[model samples]
Each structure stands twice: as C-alpha cells, then as structure tokens.
Target: MPRIKPLPDELDPLAAQLVVRLRELKTHGELTMRRLAAGTGYSARSWERYLGGTSLPPRAAVEALARLTGTDPVRLLAMHEIAAASWDIRRAESPGEHEPEEQRRSEDEKGERREQEREQGQPPRRLPHIALTAGVLALTVAFMAALLLVLRLDENVAPAAVATPAGTAATTPPHSYLCRIARTDGRWSAGINNGRDTEISYGDTGTDVAEAQCLLRRAGISPGGIDGMFGPLTLRAVKTFQDRAGLVVDGMLGPRSWKALRG
Candidate 1:
C-alpha cells in the first residue's frame, strides 16, 4: 500500500477546498496520488504539488483525475474556478502593496507644503465661491453637450426588433419563462432560459454565472455544473440568488425584480 502525500501548509481557501475534495475521493476509493501518477505518466511528486496547493495542476491532470474518478471534468473545472477566484481576492487584499502609516503621513505632509508654497508665491486666488460657480457652469455646459452627442449616437445605432413569439399576443404580458438569472449592466439578467433569448452582456455571461453559482453553492444551493442552464438545479440556485438580490422569496422571474439583480 502507498502512503498519500500531505498538502502544503500555506494552502489558501481554494487549495483547502481541493484538499477536501481529494480526501472525499480517497475515502471513496476513487483515486490515490500514486494511482493517478501511474495512470497519467506524471511523477508522484508532481501529483503531490498539484494537489497540495503549491501549484496549479495542468488541464491534463484534471482530465485524468476526472476519468479515473468517474467524475465530470466540467464539475472539476468549476471547483478550480472557485479556488482561483479566492486566490485572486486574497492577493488583492494582501498588504504587500500598501504603504506604511508613517510613509502615508509623510506623503500627505509633502503635498500640503507644496500647496502652501504655491499659495504664498502667487497673488491671492479668486474667491472660492466664484470659482465654484464657474466650475458648475462649465459642468452644465459639458453635460448638455454630452446629452446631445448621446442622442445623435442613438439615432445612428439601429435597435434590434425582437418580434414577439408567434401566437403570443403583444398585449398579453410576455410569457414568463423559468430562468436562472444573474446581474449584468446593473440589472438582473437570466443566465438560463429554456432555449429562449437570454441576452447577457458580452464578456459577462459565462464568467458571471460561474462566479454567482460558486457563491450560491457556498450558501448551500447547488447550481448543477455552472453551465448557465435554467433547469431544476438552476431553479434551486435562484432561491439563493433571490436572497442575495434582496427580492421576495418567490422564484418567479419578473422583469422589474430581475433588473434589480443585475447590480
């Protein structure tokens, strides 16, 4: 019998999740690092590093594990996503790039001294009231100009005519389809609609749904495989989504309420 290698001590939350998953698989006799190494032609040391959270596993390693364990690669990939996002957030919050309190205070003092020198060298500046009034006038003019420009642009940009589905009277409220929705453009847009038009903003759809589902899963709603489908799994996902979006617990996807979710 081969001994299972231990994970690294510095593992982040994501790495820790992976370790938990691996341990579950081990209990189920689904995989062992030595077995995985033999199957994938990777060294046991490489397997240890990949599973230990010291390094990201190659896509091939993930695929191989899925095959060996009788698990969906897509689901495994989703797990990796959670880990990566957690790592990114941790990196952003780390104090490595922050200035010390003394350094920040010194910089602030230097800026104040420079402003004082400029004030002493120059003639008394115009009254702040006059300056503020002029600034407001300039901003109003600029806003008017921008409004006109936007109106002109709208005129040039043709709108797509989404014809109502046949036999569905335009006067009747648009048939409410069950969908798994997520926030986009400060509105809640559907992630999964039953083979209908689910218009998510470009560069927003897949990644956002994956992230939202990841959060929902942590909150105890299983969103299936995060494949952006509005099926039963995603409907289960909506209860959690609604709670986070501050909507009534009802699962119906109404336009006004869904719009609030896009935030």
Candidate 2:
C-alpha cells in the first residue's frame, strides 16, 4: 500500500486526470516504480516524477505503460496530448517565467517560428518514431470538443438574487445550479429558486439546511442526522464531498457544493 499524495486544487485538471489514469494502471499491474521502469524504457525516477504529476511522460512512455498494463492507449494518449498542451500553457503563464527576460525571448522566438512555418505552407516534417503525435493531437482535439460541449446544467437556474430590504425573510433556494455535469439523474431534477439564496452551514437550524442534508444523502454522503443543524458531522461530510468533487474542501455548502450535492 503505497501512500499517494492528495492532488492539490492548483494542479492542472487535464494533467491531473492523466495522473489518475496512470496510477490506476500501475496499481492494476501491481507494479513498483522499478517494475514500471523495467516494463517501459523510462527510468523509475521518471515514473516517480510522472505519477507525482511533477512531469508529463512522453507519448511513447504513455503507450508503453498502457501496453504493460493492458490498458487502452487511444484515450490515454489523447489525454496525454491535452495534458502536455495544458501544462505548457500553465508554465508559460507562471509569474517566474515572465521575470526572466531570456525565457520570454525564447518563448517568443518559438511562437514566431511556428507562425512563420505555418505562413510558408510547409507541412510539418515528421520523424517516423514520433509521427503519431500529429494524429494524437487531432484525436485529442475532437475528444475535447465532445467533452467540453456546453449545455446549461439546469434550464431552470435561479436568477441572480436581488437586494432585499432589511429584516425581510430570505427565500429558500432550489438546488445549486453548478452541478458538474449538464445531465444528472432523475432524482436530482432541476427547478428554479425564485427566492433569495440561503447558504446552508453547520450550527444553522432551518428547513433549508435539512434539505441540504437530504441532498447530501442523495449524493451518497451521510451528514449525521437530518436535523437541519450544521453540526460537526455535517461539516465533515461537506468537506469529504468537496474533496471528492475537487472543490475547495472548505466545508461550506456554497453554490458549487450545492450543485454537486443536488446532482
């Protein structure tokens, strides 16, 4: 049982997803880092870095891992391509990279070269060993287009809350509209909240808090008793749910928490 570090929120989601898949493959194959290295040409140190998400493995390394573990290569390769692009974007955006004038010039030069090559109508010459990268990029783009297709999470989303006069009772909200997917199971149907938004928190006793607890139950998390009180039990459950959902894990049922629980 190797201890795996919890992935922080700062990690790029695309790269994070690939790291998750690689870990699964490694676990299923019952491989140590040394074993993985033996099965692939890459070093065990490289596997450590890749699995830790400090580095993205090369395409061939990804393919080798998939073969050794009997995993499908297409999806992993597509994800790897996306992870690489996204990782590059993150590095380019980092503040430290901007502080170095030399680094900035290098990036600008690379960008200019690419633009010039495109303008010249010169097809990218491919080395046979890495020729598949182009195809992988195309597949990754198509895959992303499908996955990132945007539809409203809930057609009946509540309108933004209006300012209320002092001492007026706030309106109870419908489920959070921030559910991860556009589609949810029928039990978690979406409607509208015509009322003011109410945040459900621990130590709070109200019908809205109770409803939030029930929604948590629907999401397969137990928040102690549904007594409408935000107690420690409810707090723990909220944090657990947030962590699983890659949320802030702050134990507060904000809009995103509300949406995921509602889902």
| lDDT of candidate model 2 versus the reference | 0.64
lDDT of 1 at 200: 33
TM-score of each: 0.32, 0.39
Taking all chains together, the TM-score of candidate 2 against the true structure is: 0.39
Query: For residues 1-263, could you state the per-residue lDDT of candidate 2 as single tens digits?
Result: 87998764567787898899899888765677876887688999888878886667887898778655545455566567667776765564453432432234564776798799899999865434455556556665764674353221232343444344487444333222221222345335212222223676644655666666666666788875555556556677788889999999887888777766655
Q: Residue 229 error for model 2, in Å? A: 57
Clashes of 1: 3
Q: Residue 254 of candidate 2: its Cα lDDT?
A: 81
What local lDDT does model 1 show for residue 16? 73
lDDT of 2 at 52: 85
Spell out the clash pairs found in candidate 2. 202-230, 203-230
Best by TM-score: 2
